[model samples]
Target: MTSAALSVNIWSIPTTTAGTTRFTSKNGHTLDYRIHSGIVGNRWVKDQEAYIVRVGESIYKISWTEPTGTDVSLIVNLGDKLFHGTIFFPRWIMNNPEKTICFQNDHIPLMNSYRDAGPAYPTEVIDEFATITFIRDCGADNDEVINCPASELPADFPANL
Candidate 1:
């Protein structure tokens, strides 16, 4: 008889001692995450361009903004997921959660962005904050903000968040 094939996904790799740490779900299933990145990178170049994603949470998303600009981005692994404010994570969330770096933010909100089935979809109204607060400029004077090591990394986010 053939043993059950081991299931694998994006997070399957870089799973060596780096982030192979696993957690047991209430149902006895094994869960793990890939939390990477630690540095104070660059601020956004465009208004409201900053992004954030969390894993293993019900809400999945929590946002805060200001007119002065956040001026930072980062990526980190909590338990079985990775969080970041970079442009890459959002695209990953769009294609396949399983293929995400660590499959951490697998339970993001599923919203219907469209209303009348046109080329575009209706937008959601977020909190009252300046677009520049999250991201201020988008010109050559601003940094590219894609340097993995040089990216916007916070000092320490609230634990158990």
Candidate 2:
């Protein structure tokens, strides 16, 4: 029988905030911190890998692997160094579909979201109404934004379906 690994305490609820979810490590290091609640979509999952709550911003592209048990790991690539952790998927990621977790490109600026894959970070800046319809009806038809490939998605990320 396979033994279940202990869940990493990579999350916390800040005393100062009412319902904000703070993603942190056991050692107190933060990855991606955000004030928004609810699950984020899979299209954005690759960007959120191995993140923590730092100050009020959600730091992404950090890197880390599952410390123990199985092959689980969360890796984020920060330009200089990588930040990572051994933990379970955020509740929102598990409960919601990729479409539901989708957000407008404008939200990226307000939250300080980023990625280190390329010089230009793929972002959706269209209005929320257009963004939703874009994801629902058409996929990445814009030249400005490059949608993430379904094949490169992590095991836990919402499926192409």
Candidate 3:
């Protein structure tokens, strides 16, 4: 699959007022978020944008802001799916460092699970917080997904994405 292979659509809805933005998905999922505009510590804090999207018992929270750059972070709360308690795990950070692209499949079985589930989907949380860097090659038509140690990415990759 391509590096930008996202099943869900990330829609940015305009706020009616100043500090709020509503996000709606194609599956008729709606999340109302409130923005916190103020100053925190030495740096000036901009608006806080967050969305809660639910799929089955999984409630995903995607949040980011202007100061956070172009990287949109996500956290999924698996409610009574695998574990007993409501555990919130950090899934993946998209567009890390503005250039790196990481795609996570959240419907697969755990790597060390004993039970035999069905076919693994992309949304499965195999490795929490796992990411792969995508390098865009101008010569080639498609991009490359690399899962390796932290190294300098190619200059061809888009910056501040």
Candidate 4:
């Protein structure tokens, strides 16, 4: 399979740890993330952005300002199910808690989205978080508090979802 496209954030950057990183969004949003993985070079970048996606817990301090302009953006890829630009996860795999890996045979709804296909659906599954916040700026240089729903990614049948 071809490598998926991911728009890296500024909050998930690693400073001095292997399973740690930080990334900033197109806006000034920032996040601190950490994960457990031995592979270092297995990362992805899209539209001149960068970040790391590991297999363990991570930390982040997210902001809602673009480093260049007043507009900010974030992108994430949910394997073969979704392509999220705001909360991109560069790496993904099919998961099955009961059976080797989770599989979907029908439509499943996730946090921010829903899948009409797949055996089961999945959204943002990250758990280890010291803080989670959302802010939106309407070009006033001021950030307004807002709650953005998470995207949904599901494992489907042999048919492309």
Q: Which candidate has the top score in TM-score?
A: 4
Give all candidates' CA lDDT scores: 0.23, 0.27, 0.25, 0.24
Write candidate 4's Cα lDDT for 1-161 as tens digits: 22221233322222222233222233322232222121322222112223324321222222232121112233322222212223312122223221211112121223113212223334322322221121222231111211111112123411221
RMSD of 2: 18.1
Off by over 4 Å in 2: 1-42, 45-87, 107-161
| Model 2 CA lDDT for position 112 | 30
Clash list (residue pairs), candidate 3:
105-122, 105-123, 105-124, 106-122, 106-123, 106-124, 107-123, 107-124, 108-124
Count steric clashes of candidate 4.
Answer: 54
lDDT (10s digit) by residue, model 3, range 1-161: 11121233222222222211112222222222222211111111112234434444344445442222222444433332121111111222111222111111121233113112312222222222311122222221111222121123344422432
TM-score for model 4? 0.22
What overall lDDT, based on C-alpha atoms, would model 1 receive against the true structure? 0.23
TM-score of each: 0.17, 0.19, 0.21, 0.22
Error of 4 at 104 (Å): 23
Model 4 lDDT at residue 24 = 27
Superposed on all Cα atoms, the candidates' RMSDs to the truth, in angstroms, are 19.0, 18.1, 17.5, 17.8
| lDDT of model 3, residue 128 | 29
Q: Identify the candidate with maximal lDDT.
A: 2
lDDT of 4 at 91: 20
lDDT by residue for model 2 over 1-161, one digit each (tens)? 11111123223222221222323232222222232233332222222334232321233322343211112233322222233433333333233224223332334442232212112222211111000011111121122122343234456632332
